[model samples]
Target: MKKLIILILVQVLFTLGFFSISNAQAPKKKQILLIGTFHFNNPGADAVKTDDFDVTTIAAQQELEKITNQIKKFNPNKIFVEWEYYDQKNLDSLYQLYIHNQYESYVEKNFKNKGNYDMYVQNEIFQLAFRAAKKTGLKQVNGMDYPLPMPFDTVMNAIHAAKQDDVMAEISAYTSGMAKEANLKRKTMGLTALIVDLNTEKARKINSGFYIKTLNRAGQTDNFGGAFSVAEWYKRNLYMYSIVQKQIQSSDQRAVILLGSGHVAIIKKFIEDEGLYEVVELKDIMKIK
Candidate 1:
């Protein structure tokens, strides 16, 4: 009887151990969406001149309708955007302020007349986004800093490093040529198509070494301050990643991140560097021709 009992006990332990190992090796499931965008509020002629103005005017009601529909499909519990900390807390106040005037007035009061405010008003991306969030009952979180002018010296250093063997100059020339070509095309074609073509090589050559060098030479002192500001920009963005990670992990639903094309690359970089969260690209949903 004792021998029989020992054999049965050993069998049970082996089965339990096998099952535990299998469960431990199973893949973890995640729900994350990263959507890249053109700055709807950007009123500058950059897009216009570069043939990159797709959807020049963001149709507020139509845009909101699309966003809300996407939300319904994804059912994300959290929504993250490129906004300031204070704005996140008082969305209602922002909504009120945004609706009071067109994009031009908002730009005059807040943006220092840097971007094309008239274009932003016609586009109405910000207002529409705000409205969508309110109507959908989604929680909003800030994702990035304002597009303040960068320091020149630090930028020069990065450029110098990049230019070690004339690499920066060559790349800059290539991108500038492409941007110029796109700009020429914009005069005849629809803005959306031109914008897409321009985007095809945005990161590769758009600003590249030229912008870096310009920033380096802008200031009186080191100019390094703005030059090195990219790191600071990354740090701020990473903080948003940390916050979103915490928020999403605790929730039962998924999360969606809405940001500019520039941010798309960085956010993906952060997720990979952290090795904590799994991120899905929006391109997976849309058919990008």
Candidate 2:
């Protein structure tokens, strides 16, 4: 009886050890944090340049500190920004200056005291991503933007050609409302609240929902411009996400993508579709308004 019991116990131990080894060898999913940030510079480069509020002010700088502190807590392995992917060299070289504490000198030299220098200087890349990277001792901030121009106006052109007056009115209201939301929130709730709103799930859903559902009705029978335009938008975002993927490797356990809020929803969708990464919601890490 003792011999039989000893053999059974040995068999159980072997099975447990095998399972433990398998678990240990299992692949780890990279945790990605997608932070949808408003353009502090408000350069009018994008279709809807949100958040025109001056980030150069002391109050905005203080709020930026809180935002940086929140990102530091995430302790990402890599930090990615919205510059063109091909500009990684230029981006990192500039980041190197920021890291060496020569940011002011570099800015002065590069800008040559140009007008609207404040706009260039106070971009959220400098205020948030660069600051958080230095605080976290990160050596490089990756540029993950793919310069695939989204043909947004094509949908409108199609609608206009089709003479969809009601449709045109609806799109106009949505775009205008987006701009208003930023301005109104900034005035009423301040910078923190504006950012919180920009990063919220409700914000993303509302932004992407139009592209997914309403745009289908944009084009007439001959040309589905609305649907095609939407597909192009997703394609560009997916490519940008791939640029981020190239930067990440097996060793990287976590990463943060600091991008304009417009791009976040589509990339988040791609991340979900892959089912290989765990996304960390920006709102979860942000402080209470």
Candidate 3:
């Protein structure tokens, strides 16, 4: 009995020691600073379009500078933008020009439009991420965007076939109105406040609600199109999260991703679900906490 008792004690000690080493050897989670933003240069291509306010004005430029400075203080090792993943080389080229202070001159000389720096001046990637990258002296802003078929129109057509015009109209009006209201607020609200608001739980829920609740209720039977479309949307976010995870290196302490609010909603959920990284809220960095 004494020998058996001693063996049991020895086993427990070994188990505890093994676990201790395992815990100690585990890598610390890298931090992710996710900033959800409006498309600064609205191309009127989104499902819901708003008249985007200009970021080129002197006052607007100053506000952007303040916001960019806050991002700089995040001290991100990498800055990820929403450009397509396949377009990283092009993005790197543009970023190289911006960092070298020759982006505007190159545009003027090559594009035949001297004053038109819309791509450089009026994009959140150029306005915020590029500026932040330059401040941090990073080599390139990463392009982690991967697009998938959202198929909103097919879902709408299915809803229409199902005689759910009212539901369709309800969803449409609500989303479009939200965009208009945001656009109006942007005209008056400082860019930081607008961005913080865009990343909040309240805002994220509305974006999620479009796929998970509003549209999902619109169809029946063979026309489970809402379910199908939302699935595609979720899949896209999952793939995007995979793209983001692939960019993480063992040496990277933290990275920043500036993406649209709609994408932010699902990817944030992915981060929470996967337990891979510590998320630094945009609000906290901006001191809105």
Task: Tell me each candidate's TM-score.
Answer: 0.58, 0.86, 0.86
Off by more than 4 A, model 1? 1-28, 45-68, 95-128, 131-135, 139-149, 153-168, 178-230, 246-249, 287-289
lDDT of 1: 0.53
Model 2 RMSD vs true structure: 3.5
lDDT of 1 by residue, 119-228 (tens): 44434235435444555565453434344443434555655754433534544565577567655765665433432443344552443334344433333353344445
Error of 1 at 271 (Å): 1.2
RMSD of each: 7.4, 3.5, 4.3
Ranking by TM-score: 3, 2, 1
Per-residue lDDT of 158-199 in model 3, one digit per residue for the tens? Answer: 888899878888887987898788878987887778888889
Q: For candidate 3, report its TM-score.
A: 0.86
Worst 10 residues of 3 by lDDT: 112-121
Model 1 alpha-carbon miss at residue 91, Å = 3.6
List runs of model 2 lying over 4 Å from the truth: 1-28, 49-51, 112-116, 287-289
lDDT of 3: 0.84
Clashing pairs in 2: none
